[model samples]
Target: MTDQAVADDGPGSTGGRLTTRETAERLGVKPETVYAYVSRGQLSSSRAPGGRGSTFDAAEVDALARRTGRREQPAPAGELTFRTGITLIGDDRYYFRGVDAVELAGRHTYEEVAEWLWTGELRPGVRFTAPHEALAAARRAVGALPSHCGSTDRLRVAVVAAAAADPLRFDLSREAVLGGARSLIPTMAAALPPAGGEAADSEDTSAGLARQLWPKLTARPADEASLAVLDTALALLIDHDLAASTLAARVAASARAHPYAVVSAGLGVLEGPLHGAASGPAHRMLTEVVERGGAAPVVADHLRAGRRVPGLGHRLYSGEDPRAAALFDLLAQVPQAAPALAAARDVVATTARHTPLHANVDLALAALSVATGMGAEAGETVFAISRTAGWIAHALEEYGERPLRMRPSGHYTGPRPPQPLPDATEAPSQ
Candidate 1:
């Protein structure tokens, strides 16, 4: 490879280019090492006008040379730092766009809350309206699932159908995405199998999402108070900063994936037991305590078995999770939930007296499920649906950033390429 003459310019000047050998010489490394830098994106390379080996900007080579031999503390394994304006978790509280989530849960509808999260506009009367064809398509898709499928399973299928039906889903413009998400959310909710074995009246759409979703979760008719409790729960769950599923969604969006695919990526991650499905075990624990008529025996048995009391603690909150507290407060006001409320109280009191742990969002979701006579899997459904709003918001944010910005550098710790066996004739006797 010929070494092209680089113009004499100050170090890091952008005026000229350098060839492989010259670049390597300036960086004090071999040509192969220079290629490795290009592969790692530490340097950029281009082919000469004619068919030739790589050439790199002189300034970039100089910059790389200056950075050589500088050591950086490796980031803690799996630790990622990302900036988001959607939600904040601090001081044992959650805020959505600078509004305390607890306060928002008490007052806002899920539609209003979703809009606020997506656009930073807290306008009242924001609604997630969808065309009848979209709803019908989603319903047919969800209905095709097996009888044993859970609500989240049905939801996943419904979202896929909705995406297929929407011809404009590929539009990544801000207004287009926001409009698509607004319609997509309601369509998914409406398509779920109704708890009463019959769909809620289409007119119920105007009442709010909680009303529309109520019949899907329970056979019993929900009163105004109960509907309000579910609405608050949905609002509280709308967003939390950079959850695993949210991160998954953002990653997909950064690659310009369609919104439906982005949401699917998030749902796939949320299906993990350590994430969204955490409420299932928590529901079982609460159910056992209620059946036993006391928290002491059940709590002791769980501890003796080396099983953690699910839903009793959170990694981010030192005390009670604000979402849980808000949800519990609302449940207390519903007369039909008195028994489940009492059981939740006993569990909380017992855990607090025995350990420093406190009630978390999972426990609150479980209590809500039990109180409403919904099945154990209902909490995961609620979590999945509620979190969709957050996932979309994160997707929107990520679309505006550099594509594939989340690609992480690997630090190889595995056995080095089995040190090339010495050439047969050059090898010494072992």
Candidate 2:
């Protein structure tokens, strides 16, 4: 094992490395435990001169110590600890309220799964209908946006309009919040103008949320297999543990914002390319791959341009993403999805030859959009809508805690405070 040398003037330092005893002391663990961490690949150790003993990198040991919860160093501003019963991710799979998320998605519709997440109850055949006033207001606000506006923008505007129209939006009681969420989610969906002027159908109340969402995404008529994929995607995407958008939503909820505002906070963060918008690039990539009839040149082009090949790898899962696995299984049932799905597989296989990376949810979502003729932004829309339920669940949890508990203290690393103030009359130092 090799690492950049990091010299220190402290005790137990030698030749820019720490002996095993020093590493153990720094980690507040026994020397045997330090060796265990090294064996487990959590930490790495290098050989000392003449192979006398192992010498550990000071930086790596310190990082492992921090992760082990030693308080020798102050926690960074971004490190947050909280308690909740919403979701648990580990061992290449995730669970919601202790139920396997993949299994739950397979067994339940999006609405039912959302209901389960919110209240821990499975209500079969449940439907979320938008209130008349809220739906009308959202529609008006969404209609006012430019025709080329993306779905995330429309959803953001619709949320604000819905909040404004609700007389009881401020009610934070469990029943009231649940009622508001039921109405608000459907309102956001119903507000988007249908594709090709496809009229809103009775499915708004009579069908699943995916059924209502299908026409808005594409003019193509919905097929049973395709609709099933959409529904499962919505269900699978309901929540991941404190994702960036979820953290923003939790922060808003901790500040006592209403459900709509909490959702608005989440949507704002979701618009970033690293989050919900990640699939758009993947969609375009898959489209190019299909047009060129291969994935090699497209993947090479991305690498040559010094860009990451989208739709591959995830930080959380070392193997295939579970959500992607579930979606790919369902997409196989849709006959029209075969070509795009094949393209996605080819991309994954091509990239794996160099650095093996598994397909994530973004790639699967891209294939679905490309195959079904939806716009590039359709995955983000699906993400925003499905995750609204999760944000609400987090809000509900935050509402029960002390207000403003999510506030994180700043760790200033700027110039000393005693420095004299800059004089406006003098030119600023270059």
Candidate 3:
């Protein structure tokens, strides 16, 4: 209740927490209605250290009510149209504060992307305090990770750790929202190692940073040709049209989870092997086959064994993964790729002829990463590299609402009834 609260209705009430029941009384609404506001992100509440129920900051709630046009005054019984100008969705495409995301990816840094996602823009016109401390705290967590931890896995752990650090992290103030977004993305991305083969001492430009990440698997320098391929791969994977991870992010946002928690939900779902790590195993399968000098027999044996060819199919891309095609086109340009590219082509033809399954984005990217000397397992990081952009966009989409929280329904199927179990020796028998 200590936080400042001011009633938006003519500045009548200001900072101090009010019980939900009391706040509901002032607003002339039922307690359930207040809970609905919290549910719908129209209102917020905080925990009481040693009490039950939640307390609301009068000023903040009033400000939100004012902004939302809620009042003691009556309104027309008919439908009244209100629209959010802050964020928009066109069919399946996403826009933050009206700018197209695909367009923003090339023109913006991860920092700007974060800002746009949280606040719509970074113009001085918008007065939002980016969470410098929160972001720094995230950095320390990322830095403390085992240096040898796979960059993607390390990011997952780092995200969970960062989410646990902030005291006022769930604050949905415009300032806190933007700051959290700005701090979360780069902090997560930075925690991920720079691309493989990047000189540890190189300047930290985007490209240089990418290099450091590339060699983790590649074990050698990724030449200029490979670098170009990597950059384009990143751009292509930057965003997708409302993916599952995107939905998870929005769901968290809707619940008033902080930006980090929103992104955390997203990255966590993306970590599922089916969605995120397909490319990792794909790269390994292809490399092992090619390296072992096997051909149709090996691939056929894989199919016969009832095992999946990891990267051969996709959900969204019907005939082909455009992303894979783009990556492979660039990958083909790498000098070291000539032999592997030919071998991969042969493998693709051979495999496709036998099964309806075709190579997907993962397969193509895994092949390309291998061609560029990215290790057989480098696809995981590459996927993360490309997907982080999408994660930020999804998180931004969630920020327009008030402080977010997520509470999902669980289907409980455990033992029922409260009776104590009979002693073993006294157990009833049919």
Candidate 4:
């Protein structure tokens, strides 16, 4: 076909396609970077028809090049913008600093993933250890909380106590924030009381956060498969692009709150039903589905009560959640997870006939908690712990920005008044 005829066709035409090398050259990047861009969903690639290398749409490539140029320009005055190198969400997948999050979770430990998110560098086999004083204070604060307090409440208290014990907590410098984050994550994990009132283990204090956290969520001994699932979940949950809680953290950091306070702000938002605590309802729903031996009745109950089904859909993804896909792949290896997993699948299939929503990370988390003998609130604990790394990453970014840049003028919508004042003796208006 002639090039003109090919161009007359749509973007799918061969004339509109560029090879990897061409795409790299057009974008002024290396071939490897082109692949990275594709993985990050900045560019999409499709296999050449028969048996050839990947091809990119020429139009798409040029558009991306234009975007790259525009990104270098500064924001206009009186406009607030947040530019981050942390996480990117697009094309039904999420990336952590240009690396595919699922691939990172599969290849690296949670600590390593957390480190990479914070510093953009990976140190394999690195471990986080809580300082003695911080752990002690956190434990004391958590212990003082009423037994009925939820995991998020205890975590909130733990963060406050840890901040109080750190003499250098107010330092917003990069090195100081990094030091605090490295110690604080482990402290949060170790501070929670062990399941069934078991005595704390000295050795657990030095373990990876996932190892330290497993016992706190459930009394069951950690097995190889279950531990793997937990660690992967933590790694995958590290950060999503400006989630509600992460935005809250950045807002606090914009005001120059210390790292601990940044995390506290995040935790405060995280505990709300729509954010971190979302998984708890999913966990309960999955449990009921398993016990009832069917998803229909349980799903019906949710609809009957006028409640949205939990853990089924995500606002950001039209397809399956990448995190859920990764965790479900790991969960398949755990023999104990089969029933819960099946129930989760059934819930999706059942709901699919009507709404066609895919299972989100919360449903996968619910399966993990149910299969591993964790309480309904276990997922919330896991969420709060995992997202601490993300919150700190955002704080680090915000600490470098103009202070209080997030503050905005309110657009008044209320009744404008200077007309009258209510008399104290007059009857109040209905």
The prediction achieving the highest lDDT against the true structure is 2
Candidate 2: misplaced stretches above 4 Å?
1-78, 198-203, 418-430
| Tens-digit lDDT string for candidate 2 (1-430) | 1122333212344544787777776676777998899889998887776556678887677667656754333346667855566898988999987789999999899999999999889999999998888888998999899988899999999999999999898999999999999989988888888876757555445578999899888889899889999999999999999999999999999899999999999999999999999999999999999999999999999999999999999999999999999999999888899999999999999999989899999999999999999989999999999999999999998886667755656889999889998977977889
Per-model TM-score versus the true fold: 0.78, 0.80, 0.62, 0.81
RMSD of candidates 1 onward, in order: 14.0, 13.1, 12.8, 9.4
Alpha carbon deviation, residue 319, candidate 2 (Å)? 0.8
lDDT of 4 by residue, 207-269 (tens): 777788998889898997899899999999989978889999999998999999999999999
Given candidate 1, what's the lDDT at residue 346?
88
Across residues 1-430, which tens digit of lDDT does each residue of candidate 3 receive? 2112333212222235666766675465777888898999878877644445677886666666556544442426642222232334444334544566545544544344444554445543222132445446655776687667665667776666666766667787766655555445445545554454343664342433344345544556557777666656555566565666766777877776776677667777777778776777777777776777755766777789987766776665456565566566766667777665665666677777767766677877777866766665466666664566566565554454344333435778987879698777866878
Higher-scoring candidate on lDDT, 1 or 4: 4
Residue range 1-430, candidate 1, lDDT tens digits: 0222434311221226666766776676877998899999999987754535667886576567546642223457788765466788888987886678888778889888888898767889777776688888998988888999877788889889999898999999989998888888888788888876776565476667887788888888788888888888888888888889998999999899999989999898898888899889888888898899988888888889998888888889998999899988988898878878888888888877778899988889899998888878878888888899899999987876657867888999977887867676767869
**Each candidate's clash count:** 1, 0, 30, 0
**Residue 138, candidate 3: alpha-carbon lDDT:** 58
Higher-lDDT candidate of 2 and 3: 2
Residue runs of model 3 more than 4 Å from their true location after superposition: 1-149, 160-183, 192-199, 202-212, 215-219, 401-430
Which model is ahead, 2 or 3, in terms of TM-score? 2
How many clashes in candidate 4? Answer: 0
Model 2, residue 249: distance off in Å is 0.6
